[model samples]
Target: MQQQRWWRGATIYQIYPRSFLDVSGDGVGDLPGIEAKLDYVASLGVDAIWISPFFLSPMADFGYDIADYCAVDPLFGTLADFDRLLARAHSLGLKVMIDQVLSHSSSEHAWFKESRSSRDNPKADWYVWADAKPDGSPPNNWLSIFGGGAWQWEPRRGQYYLHNFLVQQPDLNFHNPAVQQATLDNVKFWLDRGVDGLRLDAINFCFHDRQLRDNPAKPPEKRTGRGFSPDNPYAFQYHHHNNTQPENHAFLERLRALMDQYPDVGALGEISAEDLLGTMTDYTRPGRLHMGYSFELLTEDGSPGFIRRTVEELQAHMTDGWPCWSVSNHDVPRVVSRWGQGSTHPHLASQYNALACSLRGSICLYQGEELGLPEADVPFEAIQDPYGIAFWPTFKGRDGCRTPMPWQPGNGAGFSAATPWLPVPDAHRALSVATQEADADSTLHRFRRFLAWRKRQPALTAGELRFLDAPEPLLVFERTHAKQRMLVAFNLSDQPQSVALPDLDSWHADTGHGLLSGHAEGQRLQLPARGVYYAVAPAA
Candidate 1:
């Protein structure tokens, strides 16, 4: 394995800091809490840990609306605490990656405040600002992912400012060279701190259409997708003018150049657009971002055919770009709840984890996934997400997946001494780490065993992937590395299924947890419910 480019084909664990653990007794997780859990994270057999935003903020969109790129929020601890966390992770052989929310900033940020105060200020062009039309409407027909109208009026300058997300988050004007340099300088601040990598939040939104053109309306049939509910007006438009612009590539090239100065540094971009695979491929081309991941697998559709088609499409379009696959994260519902459709089978989470890691690129495993935790049901009163509040009854927001991690079966779930930011679900308590650690056959153990096993299989980790023809509810593929080929198959449904093998005489099964109750007889292979099969054959 290459030490410098360890991110390639690596399994990165994502930690939602606010809910991971809270040693501060302030109902929020902190850097000290994360440092204390480094041993636990290392035990998972993951290569790195990606911590979500803990930057200085006013808690508007939690930590996404960053107030200061270089400073740590008081709620999350100080700069020294962050340094200690980094040291602890490195001591445990886990690379550390922090979230960089460079696309926008809090309205209270000094830069945004100075920019909006007057048009002639030094930072006047730092944020996206435009004059209203004769009817005093927005400058364009763009909609915010959180709700309606992406433009917000600022009385100080008497101009409408673009905000693709919460109104409190004003989009930065990347068209200005000074603004681009400032963002790169902030990134360099972390690189100087010895951090291994960055998870670039909304990387494609760094630039906008210079023409400020109105986004074309989407047909009613094509309205439902990631980021917003069907009821949200944000889904009404094609969103071409607001994000994924051509100029963004130049900015990414500059960012990549800055990263190249530091050794062992990686950039993983989060992209979402009308053509997600296309955007991912473009953003991750050589001399740009090292890896890019989208919400194709994060959607409500979890059918085997949909998953296969999504990967196939990306494979067809991607030239030399690498992809980072993730099934669940801070922004979406837990995979088991979204895909299992209320099924409590112990194998569901394990199957999803295996499938995600088996793909031909890097992987991100969200926290608590190893424990098979389900999404918590956050009531209307306990909702903390502004996006959920705007679309209530129809959509409950991301609070369900943002709930506190369950470490033990106690009231606090061993997350905090006091009440957590969000209530910990009793169902999650039943799947606590303490309980799973004691059970060898538990999902937690299964994930650990599978990941450890996956690390040993070069074909599954760094091999080229080719899909095989299989029936519904069954996915079959072959992974080929230098002189080594492995056949991988999964029964993605709850019912048993079977797939035909091309040559059974030369293939032998790789024994593991995923192959439970599966056997090959001549040209036919039988798979039990939620079964996974791995077989090795000499390269043809």
Candidate 2:
């Protein structure tokens, strides 16, 4: 039973369908395009593939604003195409996980349309609706992560509707027991269709504060994180009342129970509450989600101290729960550019990949990450994301990291016959799959080699992790499982460095992973710029 659980210590590759590939010639990627690329993805040695939202939607927040939970969006393909894609993925020995955005639905959804019609409709209490104040002000001081007030006026109901994101995506009232069962029924539909897993989006925001209380103010000095700009007002509040309610634990248990009925299926929740570490621990405890991940490492602070402290803090909080670590996703800039300080270093991508996978948790490697793709330069005229269009120059939106994957060295890069929704970066053309397939020392090849080798090492996969104290530019850790113990060290710098080993008699270097080379001799070990060292010894 333990070995049959494929999600533990697995590396999941996230596929942003819009930018992965396109076969319909409709200027957008679809299910058929993903099915066409299964061979390429399975060759990377990943255990599963997580496809982002392809559900029916208006594309207001892209596919995150789901209109129909049980059907495929025509922009992507028909339901048959999705079925075919699932069959192909399973045949390739890869589990398929789809995104589930149950926190909210598109305003265009039939349920939302009916709920907003009148105060006494059949589904009137389906969404969070509240009466305005005597002065016609919003019901509370809650703010949207995208912009100003979280409430919008609904003239028909004579009330305000809450939306933590864009106005088109309305928040659902999970306080209603009926709403919870409906969401679970939707999950049952997919599971019946042979889906292996679910990646829950904004799972922490499913239940808001029922009292409708105003959030407390946050000091200016304390508003530096949460992946928002300093100018964005959403970061000015403590965000206490808007999300992360205690009621969420009950819903999680219900969802987990439903998943437990199906063999080998897991739920990986995306949590970003005011206290991310604590929430990660609470949400993934026994009888809850199988795994949880946050945006701690996805931020701009990638220093050695910050990285070590973040992991150590989370480890302290999540003593028994499972965690999933990722540095790049559809939301933030690529790790190569973000961690490299707006510049590209030769071995930085390899070092980042190895370090992230070496951590004691499951890993999520975003599309194009293996190619070391940098953030693209999408001009204002070509921008389509409302988030980018809203904050024009100051904080250009997420389009830079969501460009189409380059597959060849030509103009189109074989992504599509028609122009993609987003432009493929010219710099990425050199790192295309075809170009890298022929090069022996390309980042793509190194990624594959490392993953293939890491699969054989039990200590590196499902073992206990202990950090060995080291200065900046050096992250050292030890992993032990039963009788197998492994020591891993990474130099996240552009200059050469050396570290003294504690147990010379017990350690021998492992050079099989084959990305960076480090020389080990006696008590002293020399590592080149952006290099790593791996060694194994008997369990202490």
lDDT of 1 at 76: 96
Tens digit of per-residue lDDT, candidate 1, span 1-540: 125588999999999999999989999999899888889889989999999999999999999999999999999999999999999899989999999999999998999999998999999999999999999999989989998899999999999999999999999999999999999999999999999999999998999998899999999988888756769988889989999999999999999999988899899999988888789889988899998885789988888899889898998887678889999999999999998898876698888999999899999999999988888899999999998998997989999999988999888899999889999989998899898999888888888888888988889889999989888888889899986798888898788887787886578888764325467988998888888888888877
Q: What's the lDDT of the predicted structure labeled candidate 1?
A: 0.90
TM-score of each candidate? 0.98, 0.99
Report lDDT per candidate.
Answer: 0.90, 0.90
In model 2, which range of ten residues has the least summed lDDT? Answer: 1-10
Q: In candidate 2, what are the lDDT values of residues 1-44, reduced to their tens digit?
A: 23336888999999999988899997788899999999999999
* Model 2 alpha-carbon drift over 4 Å, by segment: 1-4
CA RMSD per model (angstroms): 1.3, 1.1
